[model samples]
Target chain A: MSDLADLYRDVVLDHARTPHGFGLRDGAAAESHQLNPTCGDEVTVRLHLGPEGAIEGISWEGHGCAISQSSASILADLAPGDSPEQLRSRIAGFRAMMRSRGEVEGDEALLGDAVVFQSASRYVARVKCAMLAWVAVEDALLKLG
Target chain B: MSSIAPTIAAATALEESEVYRLREDFPILREQMGGHPLVYLDSAATAQRPVQVLDAEREFLTHLNAAVHRGAHTLAAEATEVFEQARETVAGFIGARPDEVVWTSNATEALNLVAYALSNASAGRGGPEADRFRLGPGDEIVATEMEHHANLIPWQELAARTGATLRIIHLDDEGALRLGEAAEVIGERTRLVAFAHVSNVLGTVNPVEHLVSLAHAAGALVVLDACQSAPHRPLEVKALGVDFAAFSGHKMLGPNGIGVLYGRAELLNALPPFLTGGSMITTVTLERAEFLPAPQRFEAGTQKVSQAIALAEAVRYLQRVGLERIEARESQLAVRLHSGVASLPGIRVLGPGLGVERAGLVSVVVDGVHAHDVGQYLDDAGIAVRVGHHCAQPLHRRYGVTATTRASTYLYTTEAEVDAFLERLAGVRGFFGAAS
Candidate 1:
């Protein structure tokens, strides 16, 4: 029960109930449709880039498990106003943490509330669910540069 | 690793007491997961292979390892004898002649062989008799909305290539195909009717006899995806009256990389070959070649030699246990599983409702919890089940849910395991705090 609680923290449940930037946005610079074929979880991410090569805004919409949906909601909060390079570093850090298999602690200062997903790394099958939204963010970010 | 665990006693000595004994034959079932006895409820995905199958493959490889057919050595002759004997055994199991069975990589390839052959016939590839298999713009290929992607996609591609129309028989709220609309869906222009004998997700045993009759009356051929049925009960292709049927070896306590395609003798000889290569050919030239007949024509490259031998051993194992008894045990387990799960709060069993008989499986969708969460919850408690669209996206769409958690039974599955599955499942909604 403690492990389940750690994986499904209150913050994740709250984000799942009311997500940020969940609808489509017009005039976005790039868009991507990502699907986790195993569970039929899908997400469409749209990003708006400013003239300085910075992320001006981001939006998304999808349906899946709380892990995937909450991850997308968290990404909506974390991905905006950051340069593509910054987003790449965060994605790389998140990937490393997930691959650690509970060996490495998630850096709270860098990942913020997203660090709550560290417990999800123990489940090999659910790791993809946590990464689905970040993958879309990566693709959308690449289109900006 | 330091201590050996004591063996648990067999659960019951009922009419199907052999099922309890059968559990000891599968070594993996004895292992523990997460400090609890492993409860395997996902046999529909792929069943665990018994020791007889494993030993059969090993023994063959250790003593007689040679390519079958077209060899002069003694080992080759011995291997060929064993291979041909396996074909004969498989034929007897399905009530077909050895000449009527064609071996392939898996059920997916078996189905694609038939679809591609029809496509070839449409392109004027086969000889005169193949005209019975060709199709064009006005022709329609009818399948049900509940077909697995393997059965549905090939026909879709065939239609795309041959300018044919693809129609489907829709499912009702219970996930059963609406056979009431069979006549309207399958008209004179319908060239082929393809469907599953038993749905992998819904567990609904389709009315194959009735559907075959309708297709025959319309002058259309019938193809049955027996992937889910062949392993669960006694099957005779002649009695079913279908032109073709397909099943995978891995789903029936056999090794992987082997499958069987059963076609009526005359129909097989008439259809064009889907693959062409060494063993399937009679005489070869730079220009054109003469092809072998029926089963040989479809088997292109080197076959899964040891896997086929292991599959034959699996057939023998099933025979020894008696499929009728196996079927009865599974039916009782499925009824208990369905009723127990359905009785839980906020649980919706997909497919058939209460008092309705289905195959030995049950799929469920919780009210507010996703299937993935339910699966993880179950997995954490030492129970393994299948959670996904289960390769039937269109069928999932029809049911208005993207995914489901399915628990399936087999000959080795026990009543206590079903109870554990239900007990673990009963707490999922409460675990997720889903309103009941």
Candidate 2:
């Protein structure tokens, strides 16, 4: 039961229910669509960059499990106002944390609420659900480049 | 048209004590998962093998382990005899002739073999003997929207290779095939009709007789995806009048790496071989090769000897239990599963509704919760289930959902397991804070 609680944290459920930047918007510099074929989860993320290469806005639209939807919401909330290099470092840290299998207590200052997904790493099949949105955003960033 | 009638009387359901005795044969059923007794409801993905099946394969490897069909040594002869006998056992299980059953790696490979064979024939490989398989621009191959990718994709590739158009028989909201649309879709231009005997996602037993009649009337060959049906029901390929059918061993308490492609003897002989190599040939020249007839021609290289032997043992196990009784028991489980899931708030059960006949599986969608979360919750409760589009993306698309959580049963499933699953499932939406 504790393990289930760790996976479906209150904050995670809240974010999933009321996601940030949940709708696709016009005038984005680039977009990428990602799908987790194992469970048919999909996300389309669009990136809007400022003049100096900062993430001016990140918006996404997709349908999937709570972990995936909330992760996208966290990304949408935290990505703006960060430079491309900073966002890339955050993505790297998230990936490493997810792969650690609950061994790594993620740096909360860097990951914010996204660190809650560290519990998802314990279950191999749920790892993809936690990573789906991050992958979509990373692909969108590459498209902008 | 020589389908074997089921020998058992029409029993409504198995006794709980009988299911408990059957459970003793499966050693894994005793193991605990997540601190609770494991309630395996994912038999549609792959069934748990009995100790008898495991012992049979082990026994073969221990005593008569040798290459089949090539060597003349005593061990080789014994192995060859056992292998052929296994083929006969599987043939009788499905009411097929031993000559008509070809071994492949799995049902996917079996379907691909047929698709590629048709393409080869269309390319003028088998000469006039294979003319019936040839398809052109005007010809069409029909599949259902509810078909697993295994059944649909092969025909898609075949149509691409042979210039035949691929048509779909769409389903209604309840996942029932539109027989009216099927009548319109299968016509003079239709070359082949491919469909599943039972939907892996919907659990709807497709009207095989009606579909076969339609295809036969239009001079089209019918291929049945029997992966979900053969393991659960009394299947008779000859009685169904399908030109070809494919099923996997792993889903039927047998080992992986073994599947059967049952075809009409005449059609199989006339069709060009897909995979050609050593054992399948009669005469090989530097320029060309003459192939053996039917089964051997399709089964090239070394076969899955041990796995085939194990599958025959599984067929015998099912036979001993009686498929009719198994079907009756599973049908009762299906009713319990469907009603139990549907009774929950915000839950929607896919496929046939209450009182409707269906196979022994239930797929559900919680209005506010995703299937992965539901699956994770169930897993935490030690209830194993399948969560996905179930390899039938078009069917999921038709239902207007991305994924679903499926719980399937087999002959060994018990009432307590079903109750345990429902009890765990009832808490999923609430635990995820999605309950209204």
Candidate 3:
């Protein structure tokens, strides 16, 4: 493993171990059920959009293998105050990162530890597993709009 | 590294020298995947064809390029000779009379012929055999939880068409069939007992003679799905005493669009044809069409002649190795593969463990990693394996998993391939950070 990969693995482990918001949002703005049919991973993400239409709080609850659960945790931690436009770019950046197409050119600092999984892109099949939670978040945000 | 092919060495020592040499015949095994030699562990889906089979096909299309049983010309005679010769080869390979074999698009169609015949009987369209196959209220069709969809669903459809009931033999935690319970279920009501000889997913080898005995005692016809077994084992359908047997050519180093259905001559002569068209008719009038004998009555429309010729060559190749030797060689490889995968931490095998009863597969769940991820990791490493339910969802449910990664083997597989797969699997969970 490269030095950068080692650093990334640590970041993923940290977010996976201690997620930000992982319960049902008491008064959420939008929610959706997400399933990775390929791997049988399922998650339900609920979001709370603020009065100004920015992501206020997001949380999730689901059951799956570790990669999916950890990906969900990272998504929960990163959703706090971003507008819809910013999150769309994040989704695109995440797609590119997972594909290992180019450098992860988004605001890597704001990826808030979710960036660790960026190195996991090499294993093409697990990208869907690692992206399960983020997909659910993106879906919920689209529905919230 | 001694550069010794340990898998081949073990096979060569197993009284099957010819089978060991079959490795040199397949061209795909020499190709590289991810810069490493491709370790093809997915033969259960389809076996790689050898040069002889491919060349035979090319020769047939190049030289004997005409329709069979037609024209009364030399090309017609040559084409017909090639087609019938292939049939005789396949029939002899399985110890069935050549007249008993019927060709179809694939095994599913072959089985559907039997199932639909019974269905026609229940509807009162079947003739003298109607009483033999007719199933209505109180009649039963028995199978097991480990059946591939091709074997299971046909019976299910049969039961729904008639008022006949469908009963299943259950599998234990390790995926072996509960044969003792099967003895009780296959009673007088059973009109057909259909199942796979080797499960496509679990890789557990069922007791054919035992199962056939129970079905026969009840006066029921037995249908064996030899899709998984035929390619790996030395099978004598007559010895097994099955009334009908179905298998595909594609999975056994033959061409696609060709399959076999072998029936007891007496039973086939009695049943009605499920498909009726041009070549299958004995004679035709504006009022009705009289169908031909057993084999012809079932093979409707144009046939997979070239593909059938290729399949016959495949049988010849397997015969050169000797089926008994092939069975022994594969069983040893299966055990080594099982031990290798089973020893990996947190991995749970989905079928009968060890040498007690297994064919050529190992379906497994890595403790915390999803099957697709394991598949991808192995794919990245250039080691191809099957992932997901393996089209045996109910079997997966019985094992308490929605999906699993299956590493299947064949005559051409080597120990180094198994080692490559195992090494990559050991590092998989850690690669995805699921390793606790």
RMSD per model, one decimal? 5.2, 1.6, 5.5
Worst 10 residues of 3 chain B by lDDT: B1-10
The per-candidate TM-score of the B chain, in the order shown, comes to 0.96, 0.98, 0.95
Error of 2 at B259 (Å): 0.6
lDDT at B27 for candidate 2? 95
Per TM-score, the best of the predicted structures is 2
Per-prediction DockQ, in order? 0.76, 0.90, 0.28
Tell me how candidate 2 scores on lDDT.
0.91
Give the C-alpha miss distance for residue B394 in model 3, angstroms: 1.0
Q: Judged by DockQ cut-offs, is candidate 2 incorrect, acceptable, medium or high?
A: high
Candidate 3 A-chain TM-score: 0.82
lDDT tens digits by residue: candidate 1, B95-198: 88999989989999999999999999999988898987889999999999999999999999999999999999999998788988877998899989999999
lDDT of 1 at B127: 86
Q: Write the number of the candidate with greater TM-score, choosing between 1 and 2.
A: 2
Where does model 1 exceed 4 Å of error?
A: A25-27, A48-57, B1-16
Model 3: share of true interface contacts reproduced: 0.36
Candidate 3 stretches with Cα past 4 Å from truth are A1-145, B1-20, B285-287
lDDT for each residue of candidate 2 in B106-188, tens digit (9 for 90 to 100): 99999999999999999998978998788889999999999999999999999998889999999998879999999999999
lDDT-sorted candidate list, best first: 2, 1, 3
For candidate 2, list the clashing residue pairs, or say none: none
